[model samples]
Structures are given as structure tokens and as C-alpha cells.
Target chain A: MSLLKVENLQAKIEDNQILKGLNLEVNPGEVHAIMGPNGSGKSTLASVIAGREDYEINGGRILFEGEDITDLEVHERAQKGIFLAFQYPVEIPGVSNANFMKSSVNAIREARGEEPLSAKDFLARMREKSALVEIDKSFMSRAVNEGFSGGEKKRNEIFQLAMLEPKLALLDETDSGLDIDALKIVSQGVNTLRNENNAFVLITHYQRLLNYIVPDFVHVLADGKIVKSGGKELALELEEKGYDWVKDHAIEEQTA
Target chain B: MTDFNEDKLIEEVTTSDYKYGFTTDIEQEFAPKGLNEDIVRFISAKKEEPEFMLEWRLKAYRHWLTMKDPMWAKVDFPKIDYQDVYYYAAPKKKPQLDSLDEVDPELLKTFEKLGISIDEQKRLTGVAVDIVVDSVSVKTTFQKQLKEMGVIFCPMSEAVKEHPELVKQYLGSVVPTTDNFYAALNSAVFSDGSFCYIPKGVRCPMELSTYFRMNAALTGQFERTLIIADEGSYVSYLEGCTAPMRDENQLHAAVVEIVAHKDAEVKYSTVQNWYPGDKNGKGGVYNFVTKRGLCEGENSKISWTQVETGSSITWKYPSCVLKGDNSIGEFYSVAVTNNFQQADTGSKMTHIGKNTRSRIISKGISAGRSENSYRGLVNITKNAKNARNFSECDSLLIGDKCGAHTFPYIEIGNSSSVVEHEATTSKVSEDILFYCSQRGMDEAQAMELIINGYAKEVLNKLPMEFAVEAQKLLAISLEGSVG
Candidate 1:
């Protein structure tokens, strides 16, 4: 059985339809990459699945371990092991990174009917995780994402992902503004958090990130639907031949 | 399996009650409801003030008769009838207590409910508390320790007798009898408040604090607070206030004056949580306060920090006059208004000496149809060469029905002065809320964290005990007002 499944998904923003008849399924331990051009509804699918209010789900069924979760709130989904690494993380002044992560972790624990971790336990965990991401201990006292460089911000997102230990992770353009070193760090963090019982949906505009965190399957999303599904070679093929080839082939297949 | 009522959920998520509303049942000394020259004389006579002090009170009374009420604040309220309230109401307990042991049990219980027990607070928080019930000071703890360091901390009535020369010299120096309407009224009929005098070259041993409790109905509390830091001395003072719930509105008009002599520093903090009116705007306290400090000597400094979260209508401007060369002044404030409350508060920094500096930071949060504003003024005199001033005011609106405004007045007479003023108004974005909730925090916790973060700059200025209480109060003040 699939760990996550979407059947006949249709979504809209205002009156304009963005996702029409979208379908996908991912079993446990699978890593899938959704590659598409700008305005091809890739981000829309990620946001709708994460329960953002901007996109209206006209018709869809989202099943997480065969349990329908189409109406869950963003935080509810988060508590149920869904994580979205935002494309542009927000800067919250005076909220320290350590404090925010601790609170987030405790909140998730509370939702799962567990007691809050003591301060000593929480700090010990933070020190361990900080070393994993190479984040300076002093960064824990500074405001969250405030005055952080772009690379640092992306790394902070992964730091949170590691802290929450979500079962299904969505990386939305996480490599948009990262340098080579930052991209390596972020992908390494993702690779570290992946396990046999969890899945990942990497949404991106380029094939460079796939080189760092190798994906098992690549789906070409065009206009609202997945036009083609293939193995890792498809990403290299699309990168070399451009999206026009995929679009023309998809149109030909539809006509034929 | 469950149905959600959006409106009810929103209401439940936003409504917060006053935490320190517990009242103690105790007998009280009461004065007749009215205002007159006899009432002033009666209060002075009750304190057994010297003939010279009585003469001063009579002079202030005569001047107050000719004064008119000032209505420049943006707050709207019914005109206060000075004749319809009692000018003096104190607990009918003993006038003198030999020690904290002899103090009345009811009064002690009241202080405990307000989180300021005489013995425990002194030992745990290192705060010297002077508990003022209604219009008179009940007891002042830690006077012996403070006196060992040549610090004079007592009630205003006692200060008149013990430190007569100091009171005579500094009284009405910063704010005169003819300053304003409320000041004039306070001058004539002020019952009691805290007075502190730190001797030269000495720092206060502990934080000097005063807790004011209004426990009587239809009473007007006029408190006069004066603090003087002699040359090379330093002191930190904290004040907290609360009131019992009553159907009739109470009046609290206070005057706090501070003097920082040459090279001296004075830091004053206030956590004001008086009863704000209920949802329909029926009953609460009307707080009209005049607080100012004078940096009279060269290199002197004065700082004012306040967290105001209560009152039906608050009209206050804690100001500073930097008259000494190279002196400094600072004001940090966080004012939160909910329900039908209204607040018009900020600060004024007047630069009169060369090389003086001043900084003002004001944060106002408005919710539940409340109106909050920051009105400030910064003036540089012609002789103030190379003076510097910076002002920042930010307002946060929780709901569409509320409003926030900033009115800053900047007047520069010195050509060499540098002054900057910035103001911004913002609402809690849905995106920020969603971000927090996505991290598994409920809406209430998310709102609290965000609000705490917004208020961190000013909240850090408060003393430790008061800072924690103020943080909790900030969260409670925003309850039932956010969704």
C-alpha cells in the first residue's frame, strides 16, 4: 500500500483552475522529484497539500496511510508528520531560533499526548542538533531568520526539519538561493533525516538539486497534470532537451 | 465528529480576564464625598504635617481654584466630578505597625493576592515594597536595610517629617502647583505616596518598589511620588498598581517627580494593571498621571520604563527635562488596550543643555474596538549645542474595529542637533499566524509568542520580577481579542 496517495485532484485559485486531474502515489522510503517550469502548478500542488488557504481544492482526495486528510489544518497536518520547507522563510524579530524550535517540538509532542521536555533535556537535544547542521551555538540566541544570510536561512529550515522529524517532507524550491556549499549542507541534512518509513516530495525548477540528493523517480508536470513519469534519466534529458520537447511529446501523445 | 462555531471559537480564543482581581474584605477609614479647602486641610492635619507644609498646601489649594481642566489628550471620557468622590479612604487598621508581624492580616492578604507579600517579596525578589491601600501608606518594609546605606525610602507623609529640608527644597521644583489641572488637584489633596532619597556617592542596596491598591468604591486616589538621587548616586524604583472591581469608575491622578543630580542616575519602572472597563465600557479606573524627571546636574541620567495594560482611559506622558550638559534621558513603554479602553500615552524629552541626549521607544497594541495612540514631543533649546534625540513608535492592531495612531512633535532650535523620528502601524498577518500554527503551536500560543516578541524591546527594560509579570499581563491583555 502507498504511504501517501492523491487521486483525481483538482484545485483552483479564485476562478482560474491551477491543478486539474492530478494523481500520484508514493510508498514508504520513496523519494520523488516534481520538475516543472514556472506557473506549471508545481508550487500550487505543494501548497494545497500543505493546507495553505490560497488554493481552493475543488475536488480531491488526499490519503495519508489510507486515512483521508483533505480537511486537516496546516498545523494539524504538521503535527501528523507533514513538513514544508518554505521557499522564502519569514523573519520573526526577537524570536530566537532555539526558542522557536523548542516550542515547535514541544507543541508537536503535546499533540501526540506526550509531556513537554524539561529545559535541560530540550537544551541537550538542541546542542546535539546544532552540531549536526554546523549551526553556531550563538545563533540560538539571535532572532529567527532575522539578519540571517540566504544560505543560513535555508539551513535553518533543514535544522527545523531534523528537529520535527516529519514522516512526509516537501522541499519547495529549497535550492533557489543557495550556493554550492549551502546546497550541499541542505541536501546532506535532508539525506540525514530520511529513513525507511518516511517519504519526500522535492519540488524544484532545476535539475542541479537532484544531483546532490538523488531522486528515485522524476515526474514532468506541465500546465496542470503530470505529462510524463520516468526514472532519474528523465531529469537529465529534460535539462539537456528543454521543457519544449516534453510539452510537444505530451501534446502528440494526447492527439494520438 | 465535532462541529466548530467560528464566532464562538474566535470569542473563546480572544477573551482574557484580569488575573489580579481578587479582593480582601477589610474595614476602611472613609472621607466624605466632595472636594473643598477643608478636605485638603483635613488630610494635612491628619498627617500632622508641620505648619510650613500646611501653608504650602493652602497656597496650592488657592492656586488650584483658579486653574482650568486641560483636555488636550486624544482620549474621550466623561468629565470627572471632583465633588462626587471621597478624597481619603484608608484601611481602618492601626496607623502604626511596629513590624511586619504587627501588620493587619487582611492588608497582608491583599498584598499576597497582588503578588507582593511584605516578608516573602523582600527576601525572594529583593524588592522593598511600600504597600499603599486606598489613600494612605500601610507599611514600608526594608527601611532599616535601606537606611543603613543612607537611602531614605518612606511614605510622603513620613518624608515630610523626617526629611523636611529635602522635601521643602525639591517639592514643586520640577512641576509647580500651576502646572496642570490634575497636578494642581493632586498637589492640594494628595494623601500619600513613596519618597526616596539616595545620599551622595551611594547606590541603593535593593530595588525600591511600591504597590498601590485601590480597594474602596467612589474614591479618588491622589498620590505624590518623589525620588532624588544625590550627586554620584544611583537607584532603581519599580511601581505596580491594581484595583478592585466596582460599578462606579474610580479616579487615580498621580504625580511622580524625580531629580538626578550631577553624575547621578535614576531608573523608574511601572507595571500598571488597574481595572479596565468591561466589554460594554461600564466601569473601570480613569488614570490621569503626570510623571517627569529632571536631569539637573551635568552628566546626570534619567530613564522611564512602563508597561500599561489596564485603565478605562489613560492620559499620561512621563517626560524628561535634560538641563545638564552631557546629560541623558530614555523612555521605553508598552501600552496595551482591550475592550472599550482608550489610551493616549508617550513621552517628552526637552533638551536645554549642551550635548544632552534622549531616546524614546513606544509600542502600542490595540484590540476589541479600543483606540490607542502615541503622542510625543522632542524639543531642543537654542543653547543645546550638539544635542541628540531619537524616537521610534510602533502600533499593532489586532482587529479591524480597533485603531492606532502616532502623533509626534519635533522642534529643533539648535542647528547642530541630530534628531530622527520613525513610526509604523501594522496588523498581525495571517501568514505569520499560519507559520506558527504550521509548527504545531495552537492559535493562542502562537499569538502569545508573536506578541511577546513584538514587546521584547520594551519588556526587557523592566526589572526581573516585574518583567515576568508584565509578560504574563501582556498575554492576558490580548486574550479573547485574537483569532
Candidate 2:
């Protein structure tokens, strides 16, 4: 059975419809990549799944581990093993990265009827996980994402994902502003955290990210709908043919 | 539907009481309800002050009669009728008691509602606290521990009797009673406040704090606080204040003075959340305070941090006077005004010694139709050839109807001195709100985050416990003032 599913998802922002009757599914232990143009509503799907309030779910249903979670709050969804790595992470001034991650981890732990980690235990775990992403110890003391470089911000997101250890991770344009060296480090960190019981939904506009972390499936979204679904080789094919080819093909199919 | 129903509705609206409107019924002593030489003498006699201190109070009262009320502030309020309110109110005199058993249970209940029950604070935080209810210092905890460190912490009335020589030498030396209108008034009829003295070469072991509340009706509170850090000593003092809401506005005129000797340091923090008036501006406190510190000896330092979010009309200027060579001074303040409240509050830095330095940071948040202003002055004396000062004042406006203004005065008499001042005013932007909303935070939470971020520079200077309370107070004070 599929671990995550979205059936007939229709979303609107204000008066305009952003996602019209979209459908997708991902099985456990599988990585699915969604590629689309700038206005094809890829980011909107990520936001809606994370329980952001701006977009209204006019009609649809979202199932996480076979349980409907359409009306949950952002933090509630996070507590239920869902995490979203923002495309542009927020800069929370005066709140240290380590402090924020600890609070978030403890929040989820408390919700699951578990005791909170002592300061000593929490610090030891943070030291080990931060080293996995090549983050310096001083970075944890600084405010979250404030005055951080673009690549550093993305790395911090993955660091949080590692700490939370979520079941369903959504990566939204995580490779948008990274250099080659930083991209490799981030990809390695993602791969290290992947396991058979969890799944990932990677949203990107380019196929270069797929070169480092291969996806099990690739879907092409056009005009708020998935126009084509294929295996991993489809990502390279679309990279060569470009988005216009998919657009024209969809129009042709509609007319026929 | 009948005429009797209309009468019931009017009665229900007129009888609503304030949340913190409970009063203690133990006060028995009070001076007359006017300002004169006789009233000054009466207060001094009631406290049983020494001869020298009584002479000092008399001189201050004589000078105050000739001085006029200051009108330089932008605040507008009715003239204060000094004769219409009682000047002093204290608990009935009791025999000197050794333990908490002798304390009145009703007074303890009042402190519990103020969130600083003596027994509770002692058990939970391990910090010694002195409760100053209405106009008297009721109880002080942990006296023996402070005595072991050679520190003197007690009520001013007790200090006058126990350490008369020290009181006589430093009482009016730093801030002369003739400094200003409010300070002089406080000097003449001040009832009681905390007095702390740290001896030479010793660091205070615990945080010294005082919680002041105004509970009596139609009474003006004139509290006088004095702290002296002797040579090579260090101390951190925290003060928190609140008042019961009243339909008739009450007056609060307070004077706080501090002196730091050679190689000494003093850190003073205040979270002032006195009752501000209702939405229609019916009633609140009129806070007029004069607080100043003097860095008297070389290598001494003084710092002041305040989070002010109350009072219908507030006029305060907590300043620092750097007198000794190489002394330093700093001020960090965050003041918020909502509804019909108006505040004209900031600091002053006077550089009188060569190589002296000072820093001033002010953050003001204005909402509703309120008016907030940052009025500061940085003065460098002619003899101070190498003085330095840096100042930044920023304002955040939440609603379109409010107003914020900055008035900074910089005077450098010495050509070798360097001074820099910057001021900016900006309204909360729509784009920031949209970004936060897209991240799943509601509008109220987003506003709280942005406001906290804007005031981070000043709020970070407060003690950790007070910082959290100030953040919550900032959110609650601006409720409904924002859309």
C-alpha cells in the first residue's frame, strides 16, 4: 500500500485556483521527484501538504500513512512526522539554531508521551548530527538562518530534518542557490538519513539535483496537473527536451 | 423590553471591578494631603530620620516651591493637584518581628496576586525579594546571607536609622533634591523604597529584586531608591512595578539614584507594566520618574535596561553622568504605547572624563492613536578630549493611526570627541506579513515575531526571566490595536 497519497487535490489562493485536481502517491522507501516550470504550482503543493494556511483546499484529500490530515495545523502536522524544508527559510533573530531545534524535538517528543532529553543528552546528539552535515559547532550558537549564506541556510534545514527524523520529508527547491561542493554535502546528508520506513517528495525546477541523489520516480506537472509520470530516466529525457515539449504534448492530447 | 430592563443594563456596566483591585487594610499612618514645609517636616518626623537628613529635606522643599513644573515634554495632561491626594500611607506600626509569622495574612494575599508571594518566590527561584506594597516596605527575605557579604539591603526608613552616616553622605550627593520638579517633590514627601549598599571588593551572591505595587485609592506614590556600589564591587538589581486600575488617575513620582565607585559596576533592569487606561482612555497612572546614575570613580561602569509598556502618560529620562576618567555608561530601552497612552521616554549621556565612552539604544513601538517619542541628549564636555558616544533610535508603528517621533540632541564641545547618532521610523510591512502567513503562522503570531525581532537589540540586554515576561507583555499590550 502507498504510504502517502493525494487524491483529486484542488487548492485556491484568494480567488485564483493554483492546484486543480492534482493526484500523486508515494510508497514507503521510495523517493518521488516533482519537476515543473515556475508557475506550474510545484511550490504550492509543497506548502499545502505542510499545512500552510494561505491556500484554501477547495476540494481534495491528503492521506499520510493512510490517515487523512487535510485540516491539521503546521506544528500539528510536524508533530505527526511530516516536515517541510522551506525554499527560503525564515530568519528568526535572537533564537539560536540549537535552541530552536531542541524545542521542536522536545515538542514532538512530549506529544508522543515521551520524556524530554536532558541538556547533556541533547547536546551530545546535536554534536554528532551537526558533524554529519559539516556544520561547525559555532553555527549552532548563532541565530537560526540570520546572516547565513544561501548554502548554509539549506544545510541548516537538513540538519533540522535529521534532528526531527520525520517519516515524510518534503524538500522545496533546496538546491536553488547552492554551489557544487555544498550541493554534494547536502545530498550526502539526505542520503545518510534515508531509510526503508520513510519517504521523500523532492520538488525542483531543474534536473541537476537528480544527478547526485537519484529518484525512484519522476512526474511532470503542467498547468496545475501532472501531465506525465515515468521512471528515473524520464528526468534526463525532460532535461533534454525542456518544458515546452511537455506543454505542447499536453495540449495535443487535450485537443485529440 | 420593559423600562426596568434598561435600568438593569446601566447598573451592570457601572459596577464592574478591575482584576487587580484588591487593597490591604493595614495602613494607619499618613501625612497631610498637601505640599508645604510642614508636610515635608511631618514625613521626616514620621520616619524618625536623623537631624542632617531632615535639614536636607527642608532645603529641597524650599527650592522646589520656587521651581515650576517642566513643560518641555510632548505629553499633554491635566495639571497635577498635589493638595488633593495623600502623600504617605504605611502599615500600622508593629513590634520588630523576627519571622514571617508576624506578617499579616491579608498583605501576603496581595503579594500572591501580584505574582511575587514571598514564600513562593523564596521556594521556587531562590532569589531574595522585598515586597513594597502601597507606601511601605512590608517584608525583606534573606537578610543574614546579605549581611555575611557585608552588604546592606533594607527599607530606606530602616537604612536611615541603621546607617545614618552613609545615608547622610550619599543621599543627595549624586542627584541633588533640587534637580527637577518631580525629584524635588519625591525628596520632600517620599514614603519608602529599597536601599542597597555593596561594600568594597565583593560581588553580590544573589540577584537583588524589589516588586512595587500601588493598592490604596486616591493616593500618590513617591518612592525613593538608592544603591551604592563601593570600590571594586559589583551588583545587579531588578525592579518590577504594577498598579490597580482606578477610574480616577493616580500619580506616581519616583526618584532612583545610583553611585559606582572605582572599579565598580552596577546593572539595573526594570519591567514597568503599570495599568494603562482602557480603550476609550478612561483611567490609568501618570508616571513621572527621575532616575540617574553617577560613575564617580575611574574604571567604573553603569548600565540601565528598561521595558516600559504601561501608564496612560509617562515622562521619564533615566540618564548617566560619567565623571571619572575612563568610566563607561550604557542605556538600552524598549517602550511601547497603545490606545490613548503617550510616552516621552529615553536617556541622556554626559561625557565629562577623558577617554570615557557611552552607548544608547532605544526601541519604541506605537499602536492605536497613541504617541511615542524618543528624546535623548549626548553631551561631551570641553575637558573630555577623547570622549566617544554612539546612539541608535528606531521606531515601529503597527497601525496607521499612531505616531512616532525622534528628537536627538548631540553636543560636542571638545573638537577631539567623536559622536554618531542614527534614527529611523518604519511601519510594519505587508510583504513581511504575507511571507509569514505563507509559512503557516497566523497574523497575530507574525506580528509578535516581527515586533520581537525589531526590539531584539534592547530586549537582549534584560535578564533572562524578565525578557520572557516583557515579550508576553508586549503582545498583550498591543492586542486589538492591530487589525
Give each prediction's root-mean-square deviation over alpha carbons: 2.9, 6.1
User: Residue B220 in candidate 1 has what lDDT?
Assistant: 90
DockQ numbers for every candidate? 0.41, 0.10
Using alpha carbons, what is the TM-score of model 1? 0.93
TM-score of chain A of 2: 0.98
Candidate 1: segments with Cα more than 4 A from true spot: A118-120, A240-256, B1-14, B95-104, B481-483
* lDDT (tens digit, per residue) of candidate 2 on A1-256: 7778999999998998999999999888889999989999999999888776668899988988888989876656677888888898877655677766666677678767889889999999899889878999999888878999999999998888888888888999999999999999989999998889899999999999999889999999988899988899999999999999998988899899
What tens digits encode model 1's per-residue C-alpha lDDT throughout B1-483?
Answer: 011223333354346666666567778777777988888888888888998888888888889889877888888888877789899887777646567777777777777777676778767877788888887887778888888888999999999998899999998898887888889888988899999999999988788999888888788989999999999999999999888777789898899999999999999999999999777778999999999999999999999999999999999999999999999999999999887899999999999999999999999998877899899999999999999999999998886777898999999997999999988888777667767777877666777888888889999999888889998888877865422
State the lDDT at B336 in candidate 1: 93
lDDT of each: 0.87, 0.83
In terms of lDDT, which candidate is strongest?
1
Docking class of 1: acceptable
**How well is each residue in A109-204 modelled by candidate 1, as lDDT tens digits?**
999999998999889888877776789999999998999999898888888888888888888899999999899888888888788999999999
